[model samples]
Each structure stands twice: as C-alpha cells, then as structure tokens.
Target: MSIKKNRLSQNGIYGPLTQKTLRNLLKKELITNFGFENMHIIADILIDRFLKIISECSVEKERIKPYQTIVFAVDRNQRFGYGKTMSQTKLIPVTVNIITHQELEELASGKYLKDLRPKIVTRILKEAYAQGGVLSLNDVAIICGVPNTIIKKAMRDYYKQHPDEILPHIGTIFDCGATMTHKRIIIKLYLSGLLTKEISEKTNHHPFNVDSYISSFEQVRGLYEEGKGVQQIAFFTGFSQSLVKEYIQIIKELNQLQNNNKPNGLMSLTS
Candidate 1:
C-alpha cells in the first residue's frame, strides 16, 4: 500500500507549521469556528502576522519535548547520577516546569538579551536545586528563554577563563570524578587572584557567601604562612582540618607557580 503522505493537514509540504506552531492551530480555529473553509486563503493571511510575531519571540521551553517533567534528587549523602536506580538512594520528587512565562518575563529583554542568558541558566539551575530537583545542562537550557546553543555560547564566553568552575547542577554537583568540589573550585579561583564578586558571578554564588569563603581562606592562609600546623590553623580559623589543608595546599601551589614564573633574581608581580 502507498503511504498517504499528501493527507497531512498542510499537504505535508509546509511541515514547519505542523501541530507544533501556534499559527497552525490558529488556522484551524479560523476554519472550524469562524465558518471558513479548509482551503480558504483568508486563513493564511490572518495567521501571517502571528507567525511573524512568533518568529521574533522567545519561549522558556525552546526545543524541549513535553516542556516539563518530574525529576528526582538523591539524598545529600548518596551518590546520584543518570545510572543510579531508585532503590539505591533516597529520592526527593521535584516538579520542573520548563515553559514558565514568569521565567521568560524575569529573564529576557531586548537590550540585555545576550547579557542575561547565562544568568538565566544559573537561575534555572538554582531554582530546580532549591526545590530538591537536580537538572542537567539540557534541562536548564530549556528554561533559559533562548536556543540551547545560544545559551551555551553565552555561558562559554563568560566562563572560558575559569572552565572548571562549578555551577549547581547534577552535571557538576553529582559528578565526583574529575570535577572539583564547589568550595575547592572557589578557593582555587581565589588563589588565582579573582575578586570576590567576580568569583561569585562565575560560580553562581551570592556575594555574601563568596565573601565569607574569602574571609575563611584569608584566616587559613595567614596561619599557614606563619608556619602553623593544619590542626592549629583549623582550630584558629574555626574550620575543618581538611578545609584548612586544602587552602594551604592551594596557597603553596600558587606560591610555587609564582616562584617558577619569576626570572633569575627577579620577583613576579602577576600574583
């Protein structure tokens, strides 16, 4: 039997306006409810303006199927990733709504469209995590109110200098292998001489939290430079020994790097 390809609603030639486009639905409504016939030319003209409007607009759930879903977050103590089964860890159910008009209004404007997309990605990631959901980059991009490639390009352009910086998503938060811990990554950025506010923006953390970390690391670094032991630095700084050691190691490495970059008998000023 020959497949009836021509039986498609728009004759299968104009497939771009299939059930997916609002223009198609509006065309059907004009025909079905307004007494217009299926082949009426007025229906096409009526939908043309709306098609133009859609072409200029952005949706939060761009290129996403189903537009939303319920994703789970594992308990804090359990390792969670794509391969983990339900029985292996305690789970928290979270409703992730990708196509939120509210998010679109909060995220987009004409002049700042490029500047705000990475922030939108970060905001969506935080929103899901705040509600006990762990969204991947794909899911977060859907809520960014732009194409995923454009959103990713904005993020990459902004964060290229600090590639290992962690954002609060399952891709980074749950990946315990090569990716650095969030706090450790922040400390590394600090050691690399980034300002606290810059570090906050890059790491998707609030400035207050970033400042607190900077204060803690400064205390640890001061004691370590004075030849204090890890336990002593931890006790003095009111931080864990592991944290103190981490800071000290980063400080030593930064110092060594600075020394290595200096020419014979000349001090390096870059650090």
Candidate 2:
C-alpha cells in the first residue's frame, strides 16, 4: 500500500472507500499525475461539485434508502453440480437490495396500471437474484403485499418472455429431489445447441446441473423417437416417470417449433 493509503486505512472512520476518503484520493491523484501547480484547487472544485450534485438525486435531498433484506442461499462456489449429491451444499446469508428508491418511485407512479404488480415482482426477483440471493415466491408475495398466485403469474410471464434467462429463486437454486423446472429450462437450452458452460451462465444454473440435465434428456430422446411409451423410457433410463414425461413433452414442442421455422431456421437466442 502507498504511504497515503496506509494512513487512511489506519485512521479513516468509514474505511478507505467512503466518499470523503475517495475525494482525497482523487485530489492527490490529480496533483501527482498532472504536476499542476493549482491542481489541488481544481480538484477540490470539481469533486465538491460532483458530490453535491449527486447527493441531490434523492427527492428529499436526504440519503436514499434502498429496500434491502438478507436471506440464506446456496453458495455458488461450493456447489458440485450434476453427478454429485447436494447434501454437502453450504448455505450462506446474502444481503440484497430488493429495490432502489428510484425503482420504488416508478412503481408507485404506475399503481393503477394492470401490469404494475407483475412488473414489480419481476424487478424484485431480478435484483435479489443478481446479488446472489434466492427468494421464494412466498417471500416476494410478502414484499409485494400480494398473494403467492400473483408472484407465480409474474414468474411465468417472465419465463415466457425470457426463456433463455432463468430467474434464480429458492426452488431453482437448491432443488434437491424434484428437477421439473430446472430440467425443462436446461433441456430447452441444450436442444437449441448451447454448450454446457454457455447454458450454465445464461440460465444462472451451475454447470454440473446443466450437464446432468443434458444427460437425462439424451437418455430419453431415443426411446421416445422410437415410439416407446413414457414408462418404457423411464424403465430404460432409470429416471422417474414424471421426468421422462417432461422430456418427451419438451421434445415434441421444440421439434414442432423447429419444423415450423425450417424455412428460415431458428433465430439465435444467444443474441
């Protein structure tokens, strides 16, 4: 560390990255890099104006308070996706800002709009998930002051419009036994020709999970194409009958869509 940074770390009240500490660092950088005689004066004027104008962003001119909460979620780094059992997966507390003051203001303005609730639900889901927090539908329902059904509808709509992007939620993240939703999303991405890592990042799923889902899909594909029943495929692949049925259903849907678009070919969803 530099001599100046060493002092700040030892004595600064809010650590070395607070607004005041950063302002001093910027001023020093200006003086050192440009070798200007009056750079201190210029830096003070610019930095002060910046801090003042940015602080005015809040309508009350007070600090804006984000709607934040902490929840426990699977530690992404600790996950051993696909073949490994998830019993050893560790859960860690993640602090998330559900919505910013600015976003709340926007939603408050659209109170009477029919789509307002759905929009609010999706926004909160995305923000919390982006921060590595997985919220349940019930959690969102409470936050939105609505029924769980409303949250479910919003999630369904979000997936319909953005099938390539999976919303990280409790069920999707730490799904242990049942893999209905995650399986469908992963299989859809695989059938569309996305590689394992690409599908993992796009769907916000662990790569191990992606690989496992692909393997299960391939296991069922041949038997179904050969006119075998769901039970037959399940018996052959050792997957649950429900999973076998899901794979077959998705295969039919994707094949039909692919056939319909044969003239122009499927559009690249990666874009």
Worst 10 residues of 2 by lDDT: 56-65
| Model 2 local distance difference test score | 0.67
Clashing pairs in 2: 82-208
TM-scores of the candidates in the order shown: 0.39, 0.62
RMSD for all candidates, in order, please.
18.1, 13.5
- Hey, what RMSD does candidate 2 come out at? 13.5
- lDDT, candidate 1, 128-224, per-residue tens: 6677556666555555555667866765664664457566665455643233356666766776668888886787555565676668767877777
- What local lDDT does model 2 show for residue 48? 91
Which regions of candidate 1 deviate over 4 angstroms?
Answer: 1-64, 67-163, 170-180, 191-193, 262-271
What is the per-residue lDDT of model 2 for residues 17-127, given as tens digits with 9 covering 90 to 100? 455676776677768786754767777898798667544332341332356655555566545335664356554455545555766677688755345555667776666
Whose TM-score is greatest here?
Answer: 2
- Clash-forming residue pairs, model 1: none
Best by lDDT: 2
